[model samples]
Target: MTYRLPSLNSLRAFEAAARHLSFKTAASELGVTAGAVSQQVKKLEGSLGVTLFRRLPNGLLLTPQGEAYLPPVTKVFEDLTEATEAIAPAINSRKFRVGMSRTVKQMLPANWPDHDVGLRNHIRDRIET
Candidate 1:
């Protein structure tokens, strides 16, 4: 069956804006300008033919429709993140195997890479040659 849905970009804009209740904050999270987020949300509302947020002086308030829409949209984003991570092992582990010659290893400290906390997490294993 064919399903008619709004664009993913618009949905993401709406979801982020609704959650933060501020287009600026949402834009920061989305790595876009505030105007871009606002435009995308406007596009979403246009497609849905419903107003999701009420603009206020301080911030935003979710309309009743927005309150209802948020849960499923958030769930979709969560599910999508999980799905993508599952398919991409590098994204999940994001670690690498370290290989070094014996001379190079001897040049460094005994702990070597492990001495660095941030580096240790990314190094899954060390192989000496």
Candidate 2:
């Protein structure tokens, strides 16, 4: 059945942006650009006819509606993640996985884990995207 609701992408953008109170942080976590996050949040606000944030020159502050909305949205995402993991145990296994962004990786020393050969012994594989 078709449902009338905001797009999932917009909802995800709002949830991440509101949680961090920064489009840039949300974008980093979501693997998108800060501008994309801002646009999605803006489009969501327009569709909902609600002002969700007060954009200050320094940072963001949630409007009363946004404060009210964040909890349920966060809960839904948590539940979705939990359910997905439950059905796909390998995805949530005990295997050690390192997920890092280029910006974050650059913050570390150039030789990082490589400098410590012992670290590589435990890692069966390394994948970069």
lDDT per residue, candidate 2, 1-129, as tens digits? Answer: 988889999999999999999999999999999999999999999999999999999778999999999999899899999998989967754566889999999998777777778875666677867
TM-score of every prediction relative to native: 0.72, 0.75
CA-lDDT, candidates in order: 0.91, 0.91
Give me the runs in candidate 1 sitting further than 4 Å from their true place: 92-129
Residue lDDT tens for model 1, 16-115: 9999999999999999999999999999999999999999999999999999999999999999999998899568777645566778778997787789
| Most accurate candidate by TM-score | 2
